[model samples]
Target: MALKEVISEFRLYVCNEWISKIPSHRFRNFYYRKVMGFNIGKDCSIHMHCSFDCAKNLIIGTNSVINSRCRLDNRGTISIGENVSVSQEVIILTADHDVDAADFAGRSIGVRIDDYVWIGTRATILAGVTVGKGALIAAGAMVTKDVIPYTIVAGVPAKVIKMRREDLTYDTKYRRLFQ
Candidate 1:
């Protein structure tokens, strides 16, 4: 690896191992913004034990709350819009291997979660998926495709269950004592 790449990797490891696990919201947010280069917005809260890869490619909008133990693989890009709530242990991945490729080459694509979305606990969102505005992903769902706006998806390889109300007006501004 190049010298710069090696240094960056080392820094990422250090931040993920120690800095990201810090419980203080102010400290974590400051580190994410000033050190890791994440584009986090106002009143955002990311709880402890959350993991992020390539933090520079992650962007979170205002009033968003990412609960504890979430893993975000931002190898490509992850753009989360305003007022979104990501529950505990959710994994948002942006890179994977192409099974059809001869060499099993790696592929990456951006994942976009639009405004006012609610992702339930332990849900897994794969690469190249755009979860539309006001969508809801149920617990333990594995999303491999795009989710339509104002819809609810559940189960493995997540299928659309029903539509949610378009009149959603909720802000996700949660603050914990040891976030």
Candidate 2:
């Protein structure tokens, strides 16, 4: 092998190690966002192993965290609001292919997560879905429809499971303790 190739590989290894050592909480203000054209807000955390496809179209608000191993297909403008938390292995797909079509490829719609929303572990927000402010989607829930504000949703198609109130302090405590 060429000496140049060996040096390139070594450089990649060093860069990867350097990135890995950084705290996961700094992604909200990451400098790489400018290169990718993504608009990231203050005090947010986007952990390692998460992939943003349409980085230019992604807008992350203040105090949000997109956790480890989560994949975001942001082709069509993804808007995430303040204090939103998405746990590990969650996939937010902003596009889809039509299975019934003969020459099918795909299409895009984008996703919106409003303020104070919490998406549990491994949850999927499908194309064209809107999660309203203060909504909570449970772990492993497949959200196909719009989640209403202050509602707690869970299931395959993610039906409404319960309600959350801003004044209610116990619900936050319950989710923190239980989930």
Candidate 3:
């Protein structure tokens, strides 16, 4: 393998195996910012057991809380805005294979979660999806396309179930001990 590939693999290994197990939020955030080159904002808490595909392509905003055991696939860019709540086991993917291609090649598309968006537990957000501001994704939903602002989406392929209250003023400032 090439040297760049080797270094990327080593970084991924260190992130998944070591950094994800650390209990201290400051230490993990330090490593993520300083070493991995992720743009994590202030007052954001990413809990334990979260893994990343690549290091540099992730950007998380302020006052957001990412619960434990989430898989962040940042092969493309994954931009999460402020006051977002990403629940446990949520998978945000930015890369996928083209099924119809003759060579079965892969494609990378960014996933954008706007400000004050609440992604429920175990939700799978596929590539090229932009979740609008204040949108609520229901638990275990599979989001395949762009979601409208202030709407509630659910079920497979994630259609809009109902419109959410537009006057959302809650802040997701969760900082639990040893999570």
Candidate 4:
């Protein structure tokens, strides 16, 4: 094996071992913010200084890259798919206060990001949102509802700015939402 490849593999092992040893409460409180409770998938890249509240309700897929300081409160259920990339400071909040103010904090919802979705920097994904497979959510977007599969959305209350037209069909390699 190449030196670089071996080094990289070794580094990953060491990091994973240390991360596992980290007390979920201690890390979750200050840095990781309750990490041991969450189900972080294999080969997932979680950058430093990130926080997750609902470690119990979180299921991250393989090869996902979660950038620094992304907060996911999976009050209901937060499911992130494989090969997804969430940018820095992105907040995926699954809990919400009751809009009908008679009772506060009485309502909540879940968020789901399907496989291969790209979430831009500083975007806020509100409750009950399902970003479909291969969807591109632009930076700083306020995703209020379900994003369509293979589409690109942007702006506050994110709208469908473009639908992805790839050379191969969704059934080919990145099949999930379509087919």
Query: Of models 1 and 4, which has the larger lDDT?
Result: 1
Cα TM-score of candidate 2: 0.77
> What is the lDDT of every predicted structure here?
0.94, 0.75, 0.95, 0.71
Q: List, residue by residue over 1-179, the lDDT tens digit for candidate 1.
A: 89989988887887789987787999999989988899999999999988888759989999999999999999989999999999999999999999999999999899999999999999999999999999999999999999999999999989999999999998899989977
Q: What's the distance in Å from true for residue 129, model 4?
A: 0.4
Best by lDDT: 3
Better-scoring candidate (TM-score), 2 or 3: 3
Enumerate clash totals for all models, in the order shown: 0, 0, 0, 3
Model 1 misplaced stretches (Cα beyond 4 Å) = none
Query: What is the per-residue lDDT of model 2 for residues 69-135, given as tens digits with 9 covering 90 to 100?
Result: 7888877778998788888889998889989989897888989998889899999999999999899
| lDDT by residue (tens digit), candidate 3, 46-153 | 999999998799999999999999999999999999999999999999999999999989999999999999999999999999999999999999999999999999
Off by over 4 Å in 2: 1-31, 168-179
Residue-level lDDT tens digits of model 4 in 148-170: 99899999889999887543222
Ranked by lDDT, the better of candidates 2 and 3 is 3
**Model 3 vs truth, CA RMSD:** 0.8
Collision pairs in model 1:
none
Q: Which ten residues in a row have the lowest lDDT in candidate 4?
A: 170-179
Q: How big is the RMSD of model 1?
A: 0.9
* 1 versus 3: better TM-score goes to: 3
